[model samples]
Target: MKQREYYFDNAKFLLIFFVVFGHFIQSFIKESNSIYALYKVIYTFHMPAFILISGFFAKGIYQQGYIQKYAKKLILPYIIFQLIYSVFYYFLYGKSTFNVEPLNPHWSLWFLISLFFWNMMLLLFAKIKPVFGLVIALLLGLSVGFVDWTTSYLSLTRTFVFFPLFLIGFYMKKEHFIWIRTKKARLTAITTFIIVFIGFYHAPSINYQWLFGSKSYSSLAEDPFQAIFIRLFFYVLSCMMIYCFFACVPNKQYFFTKLGKNTLYVYLLHGFIVRIFRVSDMTDLVNPPKSFILIIAVSFLLTLLLSSSMITSLAQPIIELKITKLQQLQKKWSNLFQGYKAKLFE
Candidate 1:
């Protein structure tokens, strides 16, 4: 078997951590300016970088059964989680009625649907020259904002809005990542991050929703035509931040690096804990400065916990539609029992 690259694995772990951290701090965005700015900064690159990495690994589209493979991987879990989240929200909010709409993904579940669409889209997009294809993707992203109906339903908005990043990743080579890992590049990345954070902090008038790419230009502004330029600006900002993020990611393995392999588990499972926290009285207890520290700690611990073998073992069936982890645990326990039994006999 081919060895996995530590660089990408490290990148995945870090990005997923940011994803968790971003979600946890979202409830407090209105309570603190620092949190709001930080939220905007995180949103600018976290998902886009994640999508780029996914696109980088999507070179296997030509392999047999690729479509079928991702369908089972992405679509199946999306369906399961959609239904589960619906039931979760009904009780969490104490709603008058229960409703489950598979078409409209709930919260972070949009990534799964959008990811699948990105891959399917490669069938056509990949055929065009990379430069032309990217231009087309960008144009579609900008144009989609005009069609008010192109909202989150089916994740259509994001599918187009973010496809350029995905396409860029698809065209990237390992040498490109290697080039960014130089000492000079790393320093520049650090500087870029600081400048971006400070910019967001001072620019409070900028609608953070622009970073989400979920809403239409019409809803975001009275003049929908002008909003297109705003969306274009974000696309540029997100891409710049994404490069800085990639340049700074360490190419070495760490204890948490293995957790990267199970990001899907964290992505799907962390929502339950995050959602419960959001609705509970716990959020009110948090205060600024200190709240930032507390939120980071909670987010880190949550990422670690969800990525643990115990949690993954339990969630594997629903998320991966496989009992492999559970079976491995069972076999491990059986061997341990057999060892003790033989000892007693001896």
Candidate 2:
């Protein structure tokens, strides 16, 4: 068996925690700008980093037959959870009747749809040179800013905007992450993260729609040229912070390692729980300091609980349909062979 790169697992654990934390903070987004600022900074690099890491691990999918299994792994859960959340939304918030429209994502579940596309597309991109793929992804990202139909449906804009990060990850070798392990690099990453946080805190209220890559440049009321530059800047900055994040994350085996393995479950299931809060108005923070501390703590705890093995074990039947189907098929074949053998002997 191959050794597990604890570093990647560790990174996934951290990113998933932030995903839950960020969603939790959305409840308080209207109440506190400071928390919103923190949320903005977290949003800036978290998904990009996650997608990049996904690309890294997704290396050689074409050769490895990984793509063949993605439908069962990603697509099924995406459909199941999308419908589940749709119903959850309809009843909880009284939106409409349960509806499952193609290409239209339900809230945080958009990542699954986006991931499905990226995984499938990477097979085509993998045939090209790394530099060429990177260029293509960057250009597509830039051009996506000009198109108005890039937002929402299927998360096309985000898929294109974040495609470069995924490409970069695909091309990165194991040695690329070596620098992050050094003491000097760790110090710099910490410093950079702190400085960025400080900037986020004092930064004026700015539209963060660009970071999500879901907005059209025209919609933002910026000229095409300026929008291109802004997108380029964010792309570079996000890459920097992604590297810094890899540097700062501990490379050792930790308790969260297992949680990292089951992130799909956490990512898919936690949304329902979070939605319950969103509809119940439980996330609203009335008292700033008191609510902030309590909510953060609860959110962190809830994230961990959702990612726990207990929850994963329960969800396995739903999320691991391929495994279940394979088991049933195996049993059916075994029974058939037994009957044939018995009849032949008789």
Candidate 3:
């Protein structure tokens, strides 16, 4: 069956907005108000939902066939950005770096690794036994949740927990997705919002961590089931929210659509932008004024505008590089498939 793709434009922007806002709030804590409270509430739902959206997108890609196609598209960018930031990190912290590096594995790059592994795993195991694939994912999640990141096992959990969620997003009940894709999407989103908002009351949000603290903290912690339960609610809300946005969004303007296209660029650049702002001591932004409402609004506007502009102007070469690599990967995969047909009988 041909999958019904949902473009839900507004949700894409909303997710991007939350992503920008969440990072800004966390980074500029010196200036923040109790407003951090609201950030925690929003984050509970944001990431899991984003993972699901990727899964939904993956459904289309899977049907098309895995080439070095998705890998080149995903991995080439990962390499470009990792090396770019590796240079950046070396310059910034390598000056007097300690024995154990703060982000040696390259923290931002974790998402790419997790995504690649998840995609590969799905491709290999899913066709033979979907349940087995799910079981493997569950085991991976469990290991990360309970096992230590620094331990002998190199696999990390925190970055990969969303693998299962990513799968769920791609496979949906047509009836349910249709209901969400319909005009009734508003109420669907509203219900999801309500559920996640309620979870905020019980969700375990990190507040006191030191700057650039170990992301391994996400590996595992207390009340695993509760966190998972909360994550479940947030995941639902995230999809509904996405559906609602698409249903209500006006025709795409060149500006916003352009921004969405370069979301990867924005995600990469914003931290540095935030750090530069932090160093400048502008707005006395540290211990910023109590109007979090205004602060968050301005932060979103500024990050989106700056990141998008920088990506278009400065990162064009990398963009071309990504396309070239993707094409090469497609060619390689096509050749492999054509030259080596599946064996007829063992």
Candidate number achieving the greatest lDDT relative to the actual structure:
1
- lDDT per residue for candidate 3 within 23-48, as digits (tens), equals 66665444343444455555555565
Worst 10 residues of 3 by lDDT: 208-217
Q: What is the lDDT of residue 327 in candidate 1?
A: 92
Using Cα atoms with residue i matched to residue i, what is each candidate's TM-score against the true structure? Answer: 0.96, 0.88, 0.68
lDDT of 1: 0.90
RMSD after CA superposition, every candidate: 1.7, 7.0, 11.6
Q: Please provide, for model 1 over 1-346, each residue's C-alpha lDDT reduced to its tens digit, 9 standing for 90 to 100.
A: 1233888888998999999999988898888788888899999999999999999999999789999999999999999999999999999999999999999999999999999999999999888999999999999998898887768689899889999999999999999888888889889988988898899899878899888988988788748778878888888999899999999988777888888888999999999999899988998898865767888888898899999888899999998889999999889889999999999999
Error of 1 at 336 (Å): 4.7
> lDDT scores for all predictions?
0.90, 0.79, 0.54
* Residue-level lDDT tens digits of model 2 in 1-346: 1234787778888898888888877776666678767777888888999999888888768766577677677778888877777777778877655676756888877788788789888878989888888889899989988888768878898889888888888888888887567889888988988887778778746667777888899998899998899889888879888978888888778777756776777788778787777767454434655577777777678878877755665677787753554466568779999999999999
Better of 2 and 3 by TM-score: 2
The numbered model that scores best in TM-score is 1
**What lDDT score is found at residue 163 in candidate 2?**
87
